[model samples]
Target: IAARLVISQRTAQGHVEHILSKLGFTSRAQVAAWVVEERQSSS
Candidate 1:
């Protein structure tokens, strides 16, 4: 994500942390699952 965004690794990690907290998710796996679900629904 950092490479794609042209940001530092720590910045990417901070964004992930913000997302997790905002979404009330406790794990990356849960975040991944939510992303998949969102994509499927959007499609």
Candidate 2:
């Protein structure tokens, strides 16, 4: 994501962590699972 966005890896990680915190997630896997569910539901 950092490479695609032209940001430092640490910066990308920080953004992801912040988002997960706001959404009550403790790990990236949780976020990934939620995203998959959300997309499936929307579809």
Candidate 3:
């Protein structure tokens, strides 16, 4: 993800961690699942 975003590894991790904290998510897997569910519902 850091490579794709052209950022440092720690920066990428920090962004993810911040988002998860704000959303009350425990892991990236939870975010992925929520995104998939949202897409399906919107479709």
How high is each candidate's TM-score? 0.67, 0.69, 0.66
RMSD in angstroms, candidate 2? 2.4
C-alpha displacement of 6 in model 3, angstroms?
0.8
- On TM-score, the leading prediction is 2
lDDT of 3 by residue, 1-43 (tens): 9999999999999999999999999898999999999999999
Model 2 weakest lDDT span, ten residues long: 26-35
Model 1: residues with Cα > 4 Å off, grouped in runs: 33-43
- Top lDDT hit: 3
Q: RMSD per prediction, one decimal?
A: 3.0, 2.4, 1.9
Candidate 1 residue-wise lDDT, 1-43, digit = tens? 9999999999999999998999999889998899999999999
How does candidate 1 score on lDDT?
Answer: 0.94
lDDT of 2 by residue, 1-43 (tens): 9999999999999998899889999998988898999999999
After TM-score superposition, what is the CA distance of residue 41 in candidate 3 from its true location, in Å?
A: 7.0
